[model samples]
Target: MGAKMLAEAMGMKALLYANWERLELAEVPEPQPKTGEVLIRVGHVGICGSELECVVQRHPRRKPPLIMGHEFAGTVVALGEGVANLSVGQKVAVNPFVVCHTCRWCRLGKSNICERRQLMSMHRPGAFAEFVAVPAENCHPLPDHADTRLGAMVEPVANAVHAVRLTGQVLPKRVVVFGAGPIGLVCAQVAKAMGAGFVVVVEIAPERLAVARQFADAVINPAETDFLTEVQALTDGEGFDLALDAVGRSQTRRMAVDAVHPTGVAVWVGLHDDETSLSGMGIVYGEKRVQGSYAYTDDDFAMALQLVVGGRVEVASWVQEFPLDEGVEVFWQLARGEARHIVKALLRP
Candidate 1:
């Protein structure tokens, strides 16, 4: 056998998406880093809501027979040829969004919307495995005192930072966030950290609501009370200065628009639904502004790291860690919505 074939014979454990709604622990060939890339031994990898959605919904973009994990931190074990900046045994967080720098959006510093953007789990092999090879530039160094497991959260926090930064509210007072999932919880905390006087989180799940209380100023169960009415009462009928929808359902999207005052900003960061219906006349008449937040920019990612390292964001209170071998069972639990108490789940490989 040739040298490459010999390497392919050596395998590593991974959580492989064999088919829709099926995650299996399988041994796969370890990856080799190409030029300008580095091979990393994953320390901890987060299971994002989007990955669960892809499995339950069988998303077309994320096909089967894939390794699906993007939020992760690991140590560089091997560097590819032509790589110079990174060294072996260095701890770092992975920014899963890879973009072509020549694209117009990239040139404009909007690499998230680059014409040729590729996400780790979707466009290439991801960090669910024992080893993942990523572009050298995509790795962000972690501080000596930083916990490697917390590094996995940097990507998601960067997402929250990007969403909140888009609102342009320097000191928003009366901010309401919809949903108490990882992104929503983080969004509420980010808003508060950014000087929001009052931050309320709306969630229907009691378990999630219980967790939200730690990060949000107030927690509301909309199923028990009227959502808009409570919003009006909370803001004294003026509505919130900024409203964020981390749940992409039609109702939450509409509520985000309705919950914000005229001239207030509503930022949508969820990807639950592709099509949503909203009151076009209400938006135009009320002069409300809406923005869609995708992934994060380099600056946003850096800020996320700062927030995490500086103790501005919470990590251990809600996130649960599981051995990589348990990923199959964890994936099933998350997909079935049975693990409501686990706001964020990470796999230690």
Candidate 2:
């Protein structure tokens, strides 16, 4: 708090470019913590789709020249003035989305959706660098027995937890999820843990379909058959009690809507390119419900962490790791729909 602590390591390179393409490596700077902030020595940082989006085009919020990554697991290395109950070398998982708590959404117990919320990589410098400064209160200390990778994933897992938990109040009902990506796959597992009698996941890719099959009651490949037909067949033509769209495509979003039973809930968690056409009358006869879910609550993060730590859900099995330098290749492949076997990718700094 007295002075900016600059890392004096001569020529120690950290993040080259906040945008990966330039490969513009920058000199490592010792992070300075403002009041109530902590400088975390990041252990692991995951490359996410949001980071890819920022890199792929003109990011509306990105100021660039900053490191890119939101998911991070670290040890508290330094604390700002007035920080308490925390010590150096404390292992913790950061809630990177720093929210302006004075907002309306924050007051409604939805701070994750706060209008002024600036997610780590987008608004603040992120974990793509060696260290990141975040609010001390945003971190949750890791359990002694938890895998450190699980800590880095708490952020993304929170999204999956929110998407699944918002479906309905029902228990022990059939559920179908579209696109077995990380979120979709995780949502499938969460739904089952929340008492879905049978959780089905649909993926067009053979590799992803196989991965989903490992944890889901049924995995349907739309490449070989009509997805809507397959979903109907699995749900016995009554459609699933709940349907979740994780791919974010117009067709898949509609698929999630169409796959739900009469009066069932359809949760849209996907972000897609095109606006989809849906039948208004289609939902009228069924009394189906559709809604979009964003970010997550602290409770969702806690539940997702517990599931991973308790061995009730296996995230490690679906994970793939990539070094920071491989950022460009990874994003290109992911953008082109490559990396079929991978549900999640970890970017190590």
Q: List the residue pairs that clash in candidate 2.
A: 7-30, 16-24, 16-25, 18-66
* Model 2 misplaced stretches (Cα beyond 4 Å): 1-12, 16-23, 336-338
lDDT of 2 by residue, 1-349 (tens): 2333224332234554444444354666666779999988777777777666655664667666766678888889899998997888898888887888789988888887989888787777788766788899888888888755878887777788888778656653888888887788788888878788898888887778888898799888777888778876887788888888888888888888888888988888877654877888989998989988988977787787777777767788888877766755775677566776566888765
Model 2: ten consecutive residues of lowest lDDT = 1-10
Clashes of 2: 4
Q: Per-residue lDDT for 1-349 in model 1, tens only?
A: 9997997788999999988778899999999999999999999999999999889889999998999899999999999999999999999999999999998899999998989899999999999999999999999999989877889999999999999889774857889999999999889888878888999999999888998999888878989999888888888899998888999998899999999998888899998888889899889988999999998998899889889877898887889999999999998898898887788999999
Task: Give per-model TM-scores.
Answer: 0.96, 0.92
- Please count the clashing residue pairs in each candidate, in the order shown: 0, 4
Model 1 lowest lDDT segment of ten: 164-173
lDDT scores of the candidates, listed in order:
0.91, 0.78
